[model samples]
Target: MERSVEMVVALLGIVHAGAAWLPLDPELPAARLAFLIEDADAKVTLTQAQWLSRLPVGHQAWTLDALPQASAFEPISVQANDLAYVLYTSGSTGQPKGVMNEHGALMNRLHWMQDA
Candidate 1:
């Protein structure tokens, strides 16, 4: 919510768990957020305690402040081709479209950038 260090940690946690992370802008309309959450079928959302009330009903969420202090977690095995994240394009013409990206694709892009 505040773009603090917790946000980065949460993102890293999601990736480390071998699950795709979808970011939803907090400034977006409540209806839009609800739509995206439903569309993504998000099982859990990470946010600050203050923002918990803004989430759609029946949605499961975890507050960063309430998370355990321990950072250690078991490694999850994920293939290179497994999904890494899903980003949405601005829905200027209509509803936003989700673009899926694979871990291998992102890794390749990052490697290319470093090599260049």
Candidate 2:
């Protein structure tokens, strides 16, 4: 959750499972965190054990320590138009706005960056 290898793996796992990921900064204020969770309607949050108490009520939190071991995984089918991730803009106008990105759009941007 605080920019570590676990965070990377969790992100990969989310995308692999054909679910969109909304990364919330751990250092954000409690109110902001609550707002983001509510706005995103997040069902599960993957974080370390220490951060569990910080999460809002009703949201499920899973720590890496408590996760079961897996030998292999099957890839979930995802279309190019499927939502890949949701990024929030810095709330300069008061409330942060969520920007939804599809897999195709993100891939195109990545390809353009490489060519540039």
Candidate 3:
């Protein structure tokens, strides 16, 4: 929920699971969060128990505290064109807009940033 090691781990888990990470800050209004969750079609949100009540209707959550034991981690085929993540704008003009970043483009930028 809050900035914690578990949050970071969950992020990496999402990346490994070949899913785009759409972080919904707890501080954001519930309405905004609901909109994002719905827009992203978020089937399962990784969150802590404290934030469960904050999630609106049509939302499902997976609490990190009750994580099941894992036996193995298998890799998935992730293409360069695959979506890396989605971030929403501030919605100064209207409702926030989702900006999608593909793996290839994100990696290209990261490589460039390292070289810069």
Candidate 4:
């Protein structure tokens, strides 16, 4: 949370573990946060201890500080078609829409950006 190193590591860890990460900005309203959690059907939520109590119900909260550090990690196979992450639209018009991005698509976009 708070755009720190732990947040980066958590995002990478989630995808590396073959799980799609749905990042919820803590600054957003409580109703929006609850809506996102409900729509995503998220199971575990990794966040900082300070923000733990703020999260809406329905997630098994795991504080980033509690997570192991540089622990032995085994890389899992992730296919190009596999889900990479789910990002929500700004919802300026109405309810935010979840955009499911696959690994292949994300990589392609990144490569394109690099070329540009």
Candidate 5:
């Protein structure tokens, strides 16, 4: 994973073959990453082995260099209706409701733009 957030690693594992979880730092606390690691129940983690010694005492860690190369894989065949992304904007309620879109809906919107 690119970031130390465990969800990113877990999601990557689900989405990719030969996936390995790795943590990076932006001067962020290791504790935050550690929580993510534990929550994800990741058996092995990738980091500099040197930094592994510096990690909090119970978590398992490994060097990124030791990880195997990612498998050669085809990209996902996502339809336009598939989720593009969600934008969160604050409103009256504390929680945000997702606005879903389908490929046809987006295409129709684009067609209008072109005609304009």
Candidate 6:
């Protein structure tokens, strides 16, 4: 029952106003995480203590366990058009894709029962 770090981070980011980057191991050190943070222009990085200390300055870092406490600061109001997720596939070479969905999409799917 191990949850994906990416999914957990995305959820936490939406809830707590932060970004999550999964670390790379065995292949390369911090390569994927670094690229994603840079590409996304993430201000805060939610990661392990070792990864946090190694990253460039100006990044607010926190561990997974600390996310709940951090998310309590402010409530984010998600609008109908707000982004729901950016789910990435687990492929070799790690090509990440964003799966953007909204409240409208969810409602439309839920209301399909009427037509069926």
Task: For candidate 1, give the lDDT of residue 55.
Answer: 88
Q: What residue runs in model 3 are displaced by over 4 Å at the alpha carbon?
A: 68-73
Tens-place lDDT digits, model 2, residues 1-116: 78898888888888888888888887788889889988988878888888877788878888888975766777788999999988999999889988889999978998999999
Q: Where in model 1 is the C-alpha error above 4 Å?
A: 68-73
Instruction: For candidate 6, write residues 12-48 as lDDT tens digits.
Output: 5554442233333323335555555565555665555
**lDDT of candidate model 4 versus the reference:** 0.84
Q: List candidate 4 segments past 4 Å from native.
A: 68-74
**Per-residue accuracy of model 4 over 1-34 as CA lDDT, tens digit each:** 5788878888877877888888888887878888
Estimate TM-scores for all models. 0.86, 0.86, 0.86, 0.84, 0.35, 0.46
Instruction: Indicate the residue-level lDDT of 90 in model 2.
Output: 95
- Against the true structure, candidate 3 has what lDDT? 0.86
lDDT of 3 by residue, 23-92 (tens): 7898888898899999977778889999988999667787998876777878899999999888899999
Candidate 2, pairs of clashing residues: none
lDDT for residue 10 in candidate 6, whole number 0-100: 56
Each model's C-alpha lDDT? Answer: 0.84, 0.86, 0.86, 0.84, 0.51, 0.51
Clash count for each candidate, listed in order shown: 0, 0, 0, 0, 1, 0
Predicted structure 2: clash tally: 0
lDDT tens digits, residues 1-116, model 1? 55878888888878788988888877788898888888887788888898877889889988887865657677889888999888888989999988889899978998999999
lDDT of 1: 0.84
**Ten contiguous residues with the weakest lDDT in model 5:** 14-23
Q: Which of the predicted structures, 1 or 4, would earn the higher TM-score when compared with the native? A: 1
Q: For each candidate, C-alpha RMSD in Å?
A: 2.3, 2.2, 1.9, 2.4, 9.3, 6.3
In candidate 6, the residue pairs with backbone N, CA or C atoms under 3 Å apart (3 or more residues apart, or in different chains) clash, namely: none
Clashing pairs in 4: none
